[model samples]
Target: MNERNHISIREAIRGRITDGEWAPGAMMPGETDLAEEYGCSRTTVNRALQKLAEDGLIERKRRAGTRVREIPSRQAKFRIPILRHEIEAAGGAYSSRVAFRETLKAPGFIQSRLRLATGARVLRLHTVHLSDGQPYAFEDRWVNIKAAPGVVDAPFDIISANEWLVREVPYSSGDVRFSAMAAGQIEAQALATSLGAPLFTVERTTWLRDLYITTTKLCYRPGYHMRTEL
Candidate 1:
């Protein structure tokens, strides 16, 4: 019925899985049947099951139907954070500055990453996130204008590109990678740290179905740690 009801259906299904009502290797009920049982539409049931499958709690095969995962390789799905929320959660004043925003031809590396053709145009943004007026992280992001055309007119000065994209884009899939890299002169200057200081770097790429949305690299000053619970 309502969006809340839609989410409740998902939660209820997850409860059944976690409570062992749906054990590993067990076939889940048909979507029509679950829709009847939950008093929701088949679409709602399908959405819930899709999320479970994405989380590795279930498997869906054409012609066979859905089943609980035999050996679940579930990974924690971290909710991507708005910098304001992240800073407030840490009890720090949150602020952001847009250092650069421009349009340019997509580089070969980005084209390869997003599977775009050579010479495709993209919107590029460089931003710095601050906590308590201290440098916290630097964001280098590229957006596919063809995928998210609204980004061309977005005001990154008022809100971060990360926040805007998360709120506006309907991304279906993404991947994130984390590593440590030695800060170069530009990074060191932006982060106010010594050259060659270790910085925590996060690279993320997101897509909406087949449409690639964005690729972003967030490099944090020393002492940055990301946590996710099982």
Candidate 2:
């Protein structure tokens, strides 16, 4: 089915559930019935239901079929800003340099994070982001070679890995963490701050389907803040 039809059918199903036509704990219509109602193939209905399942609107089981949850799961929605946009918004010229880049054996921690086998090789990168010639953020990133093989040839020197990956890879899910930490000697020097100064840090891990994409940690200089409207 077309993308328009897919969206309409998904919205229709969601409307029914939210409007109480399908009450909490109620079983959803079978795929065949839903397809007939939407005048589409079962594949289209399946796709719509899959999206609802992913959004936590419904649950599906192999033998038990699909049902509306007693309570919809809470979902957090936020936009992942591009770094350049954020810098430009602050009225600063954005610039970055590849401080370090290499291909080597994945470390134990990185291997576990990406579920890679022993001796797996990964691409490592360290970057220093600048705003108007002042230090902004320090980036430490690792790319899963098995998942993004083409990254081996990407021109990271010209375009940052963060920007390139965001454009090249389509992620289905990700995890993000934010915290305040005292900058280490290396971090302080890279960020042009005093040693042990407080810095805001963000760690992000992304995946496309089951394939690991990349893991990155961004440590920002003092006074950095992240705000998002719900």
> TM per model?
0.68, 0.67
* Candidate 2 residue lDDT tens string, 1-230: 47788888999999999999999999988999999988999888988898898788899999888999988875666667778788998899999888888999999999989878899889999999999989999999999998888888899877889889888885547899989889998789899899999999989999888788889999999998777642
Question: Which residue pairs clash within candidate 1?
Answer: none
Compose the digit string of candidate 1's lDDT tens values, residues 28-61. 9999999999998988888888888888899999
The local lDDT score (0 to 100) that residue 169 gets in candidate 2 is: 89
Whole-model lDDT, candidate 2?
Answer: 0.88
Off by over 4 Å in 1: 1-77
Question: What's the lDDT for residue 137 in model 2?
Answer: 95
Give the winner by TM-score.
Answer: 1
Backbone collision count in every prediction?
A: 0, 0
